[model samples]
Target: MTTPSTAGSLRSRAAESPVDCDVVVAGAGPAGLMLAGELRAGGASVIVLERLTEINPLLKAGTLNRPNIEAFYRRGLLPVLRQAQQETEWTVSYISSRRSDGTSTLPRFSGHFAAIMLSEELLDESDPDLAGLNPPDMVDLVHQKQVEAILADRAAGLGAEVRRGVEVTGFEQDAEGVTVTTGKGPIRCGWLVGCDGGRSTVRKLAGFDFPGTAPEITGYHGVADITGVQDLGVGWHATDTGVYLNDPPRGRITTVAFDGAPAGHDTPATAEDLQAAIRHVTGADATVTGITSLTRFTDNTRQATTYRQGRVLLAGDAAHVHPPFGGQGLNLSVGDAMNLGWKLAATVRGTAPDGLLDTYTAERHPLGAWVLNWTRAQIAVMRPEPHARALREVVADLARTVDGATYFAKKISGISQRYDLSGDNPLVGASAPDYELADGSRLADHMHDGRALLLDPTGARHDLVAPYRDRMRTITTAPLTDDAPAAMFIRPDGYVAWAGEPGRDSLDEALRTWLGAPVAYPSQTPDVVAAQR
Candidate 1:
């Protein structure tokens, strides 16, 4: 938690605000709402502009990966997420499949690359590549709408104003701030963030360069009343025509055809259109009698050249977009919000280190490119041609092996994602372990307030971090095991800034690099002061 003096200083800075808000978010999707809540929590004022009055009830992304689940847990919202899962029965089997003892009640399927499912039984958990990775309990199925609702409520509760039926038609940024032109009126903010979806007006208005590969497949995701398709079994079917996945119990069917991009994305999909896609992809005599919800997408991959242009920034799909494969879109968006929220807020409060905001692009852009290539690799393997099909067969054979399964699980489960922080300690750029403290509480229990943390498990590093009390919290815990770091400096977004390794950068160097220079606390003596220097 931030100290009172620091909180007071931030509040005074907000009270002296010239703009209507510190940040203006251009979308109310999961990414936008999550950013709003994070900004408010970090002491930045925010206003979220959403074009729609109600949440979109589409079955877009239906799963939360490890990082996203850990995000919710750190915010103390896991109970709410669990409640949402229970209420909606959306992938409730995933929740029930795992017992309290952490063993699966059913066959564990981590995820898939392309259409090849990765069975956990074939994975070697003891592999060094799997160290400090996500446990099965951290992954679950949660609806995107539920996540939006949850983040919206949280943002509102934290004093963020959300305006519906508002569209951002234009935006202009000068030396100081951005003036957003909207349907309601012009909103002035110190910073502008585009969290809108793929066709982002903010991106266009702000003049950010977006470039990537063209689409080779048109995908359709929908749920509808069906008939004449009794043999359309569940799971992925990589037929000669294309790939199709069916979930009969949920009345959901997804089909991807190796066609060019849709004629026009503006046109809504119809039942006949879905029926045609089903027939084309699966060669099944399937008929769509009536549609419940339907949407069309293409494997059009693109990413922004940079995340920030002066006072304007982009996140989520606005920053990067690709085919919605492996349920990575939501996770990627949420991660952007998490990584940028604290840094933007610190900058707004006039406490950010030099070039801290620039790191957002430096770190996230490569990961976005990786996800694009990941989806592209899947598309190449599932291309509906003989060569691609034969290659997919060979890939499938590899996926059935223990080592191959682990590799796929690492990428698909979001465990292999790490920022390059240039440190010898392997944990430096990885997510901090949820270590249990001496008081019997997990490390996440102390992070709900969105402040950095210094975990001194051996109780020997307190003197080194005493001056940065206003910027972070320090907890002394029981001694960590030999494999874990003796002490770790964790950032607000749960990444390890530095671990106390002999050959790595010192703790003071990391603290200043990430959180700016330390303050002079009265408890600090000349010896401690010299140590920090």
Candidate 2:
């Protein structure tokens, strides 16, 4: 609802009013913390309010997909992420369980869809989706708790104030700013972002429209001390009743039953409940001796009609919710944060182009919708009925092939996601490939500062971009590949905004489109020499 007039008025009012921070973020989950760091990197002050006093230790995503990994890598978080991965007992045990020769009894996993496993070995190397991925593109097995910890530390290190045990109860937004009501007190900010989970209070108080389908399946995921189920081998198993996954090293198990959604979504499922669900799915007399932690989930697909309304915005699960079939939730949420953080920061700093903030929804809503349908399709493939079994067989066969596995891998890992940006270059809207520059540093190496970059191999386009040097960085680096563009503009979030071949390159429109009109120098000539000064 932030029309041009309202937006202009809001900016005017925001400047007149004093605020606690540039942005106030609800929820300290991975999405919120990631966004806090991103905002700080863009030189925006941030305050993160969390309802929980301590980090939730419940088992969640055990892997970071390609896009998720890349997001951290661009922020220079990969090393600490790897260190945290090594510290996790589950990761250590899982790694040690494999054969000392670095092989496992199970096949090498690329990813899965509806519990249908895909082997990394069967992936098509020639697949465009797999091309140009640097070493960091490989999926990393890091616990969600570790991810939260890493991001929380990073955000705090970057000067974002993260207040725990503070919950956002209500909020009011206007042209000027937002007043957020919380348990501790009230806070005023230029912008408000709800990285809160699916049931977001900010979205509700702000009256954002969220519409989507209902849940038909109840899923249980947890870690427990289980016994009397040695026959229930590790990995996904599809039985007549439902599907169950047993991973002994991780002491984690998941059961998907089409027995309607759980009545209580917030309460943790009991050990007996998990035992019963496991028995129902696996047809084994599994006994849950004790539960370390447990949670209930469902395939309830929902999405906010729009991610923004005036100064209040939504991201992560606040914007969309779907089944966790492919472990896509964490990746999807992080992607939302990565997309919104820089744009919101730019708006706070008064450097964003007109409609640039709105593009957050325009670019990410389709991906949210795509993920909703993606999880729904998995539900269809996972139905316990006979017809679904037939479909599963066909899907399983397809998944075992190189092309099919690669296709699913591309989607599940989120490498195929591209913003519908306008440009003739094929790579324009996609995540920029980690191109090796002439100096040997990868493209990701220069993105730690979270500024837009113009990679000019010819070094001839500096004059065109010098005026916007504060908002964008110009790098004189040649690509190692012949097919690479003559010059490329990469957004802060690592997406290719524009690219052109030799002699065909033009950056004026792209720069203006993304970075807003250049800061007017004292000189206005096309060849303003002071631009470099």
Candidate 3:
């Protein structure tokens, strides 16, 4: 990474803040950083504004799901992810503990591919693009702090300006662009993105209303760095006391909801409470550790009414929050960042119509609602009651089967969740389609750019996609046999928005809906090129 630079120069107005940019992200967290990386990769000039002086690399978010690993790879986060593995101590065994002698057990895990049960269908059916990037050797564990540093560094390296210790106070947008007021000063930009924490300052300042279903929830948490907790294994523990353990590499982040206060209230936590809970559940004199941080909170199970509001868009915690049932928050936030980044870039660069920005909400809002629903379902099913525990145990038994394991792993990883977008044919907005290459290579190889790919089935699929080649990253794969159909249309968000025997009307509509069907490619014809020359 380049040497750290101050937010702006005090000597000159132009030097201190950018007069204009393709995108301006508020809050340089993972969502902001990942989005900045994506925009920069797509050739957009981006500015990322972070409020905190130093990275709050601690407190939460330890597990990286299979889909998240795939997203990290898409946003140029593979290297950091690789580095993150070095700091991890892999657990040979993990058990999702419960009361009355029942637990969800996974024997082995290393990287992207877990022994967990959620991915059997994809693997057994030989899904080509199911992201075979992780193995037991690399990804089951890592430090949250390290990940923050890496993503922040990658964002900076990719040409996005990231400024920490700079708070975004407010913003105003005109027909052309937006002007953001910050602690450093006022900076102008083409667009704004709010990736701030749950109580996002950007969302609040934008005057957008947040509406969603209330969580049937209450919760408390403690972040402790107790030693010897290692090799105790990884994963979560739902106890009869209405608490759960988030045992990550750094420490255990225990959260439980007992008394229903506000949806989110941070009450102080103490040693006595934890020790009592531990003894009550494990039947042992528990070893204690230093209290890094403690909080009491209630699950909101709420999502923002909309993702984009005029010039400012909310992402990550700013957009949604719920029980950490599936470890969905981080992955979903990453998805939010990836979805909005390219749209803002395209609009700023004038490749897409202004309406392109509207798709962000249309595509992601429903997905956010889905995650909230799943969390609520998990909360209800995980009440620490004998019946709930027994049901979970039954599910675990099913997980022992190959079919069951893959489903559980993939679902919990959030990789299985894809948005239902209109205009997408069978394969348009679907997960990366894994097809064979004539050269005997994997289909995922061609998806390196993180853009939508038009896969040619008859190899003739290329002829259809060639005209808009520059607008979309079209690729050629093996011929479609009876096992697979004709061609498949893949969308950038890794979902099959549309697919099937390629037809003119649906393809036209799908293209138009997603990419504004990029009116033209290269923005220059041979005649125009000659004229310019």
Candidate 4:
């Protein structure tokens, strides 16, 4: 018989096992794979533990937003992703107006908020507030699985050890390191990161507090063959019961019903279950003949009260979750990985500045809260109540206007998000634009190696930056704009760290602040110097 004392002894023995690697990442989704690749590039050993034995082929998110697309390009993975999957042009159809002649005109939109269209024509690229940025071609569509496959390939090529069918059951952390207790065994590491989706075992085991609102409505998404189905056409539709959408090409059907009860994640949704949801939302007797994949979601918004508790940190959906509205979940999670990867890697390498790791939560928590509130507002506008319908109409009208559409477009595309970093420059906290150098090379062309970039147009800061060459890359280039600064400092994640005329003291301080102290040069001994002379 296994008594309490014996079990405790076994656990203690397991915890005393040898250290595994520098970092152990829980879950092998996009976030985990991306982090693993980044950590590998930054010279840290990583082990990714995933419970799933194989990749899930189900189509969850169908498109990548502009910011995520730019991230992929910055990493030189865009071409590889294109080679692996077919690219399709995508457009956001905001508000189509029917004229008196019964003809409708399609107004081009970058995206939408709460079903209200954000127009592309309304965006002024030259506006300083908008940072002279234009959304990428809307027609680019890539499958979620394709993205995961590409990331997995990249991570494996970089020598990250990925173990499948391994579940992290518990963990214990102290000042020295963390011991992750998994089904296989206890693996010690300098750090443990939870990238494990919404119901993260790592988060729960670490005793992180997740507090948020309960789900207001139950949502369903399924791909199936239908029989005796009425053609509701393709696009979002709001009915008296709730909402429903049908896409014939993809053989996809989706519905949202305000039933006030959440679905069980353990329960496998059947064809009949999807049929019932369809009937309830559309009030149509559509019979489902087969179900390829059926899943349930909710607006159960939640976020970790803190991202890091000791050495255990959280990222991606493990840190925050919300309704997958406007396809922001994947984009937000990818952004989280990008932001956390370099910082965590530096922390493991002991090269990070003071409070650098703390900035992960400081910067990302507000962004996560914004996304959660964004989805919540969408849900409120999409409710079946009369007030919601009236408000939706008002929002639709506002979305058709130029200013309103531009604002929404910026928000939805993530171009408008600016971190509250300490800088007066307009581009400091914004996404770095693809600056065109004098040689016709773009900024992304030089960022493939994942190192900080220092662009000096006038070549004045060459001596000042020589000390930090090992930690940063310096380039001499013509000014990107007529009023552009003489020099600019860009972090590894492609955010402007500092921008101004080249000043020795300021540049040195900025380098120390972002890239850690410069490597010390060993002085020559007196005898060696005399011999050389």
Best by lDDT: 2
Residues 1-533 of candidate 2 have per-residue lDDT tens digits of 33333556666766688789989999999899999999999889999999999889988888887788888998888789878877877667556556754445655786789998889899888876677554543327888888999999999999999999999998887767889999889999988999999999988888888898899998899889998788886899888888988888778899999989887777767888898898888888888888887888998999999999888899999999998888889999999999999888888777777889999999999999999999999999999999999999999999988889988988888888899999899999988888776666777877787888877756776567777877777677666788788888899999999988644335788888888767667763333121121
TM-score of 2: 0.93
lDDT per residue for candidate 1 within 1-533, as digits (tens), equals 12323545545654565589889999999899999988998899999998999899877888898889888888878878878877775466656776786557877887888988889899897987665555324436778989999999989999999999999999887755778999888998889999998999999988899999988888899989988778877888888788888888788899999888888778888888899999988888888888888989999899999999888999999999999888889999999999999999988876777788899999998988999999999999998888888999999999999889988888887877789996678888988887655555777877887888877655565566777776687776653355667778899999998986532338778988888867777676312111110
lDDT of 4 by residue, 246-332 (tens): 776667888888887564656866787788889999877899988877778888899999999888999889999999878888888
Off by over 4 Å in 1: 1-17, 129-139, 458-463, 501-505, 521-533
Write out the backbone clash pairs for model 1: none
Query: In model 4, what lDDT does residue 425 have?
Result: 76
Better of 1 and 3 by TM-score: 1
Q: What do the candidate models score in CA lDDT, each in turn? A: 0.83, 0.84, 0.62, 0.76
Q: What is the lDDT of candidate 3?
A: 0.62
Q: TM-score for every candidate vs. truth? A: 0.92, 0.93, 0.75, 0.88
Reference-based lDDT, residue 501, model 3: 76
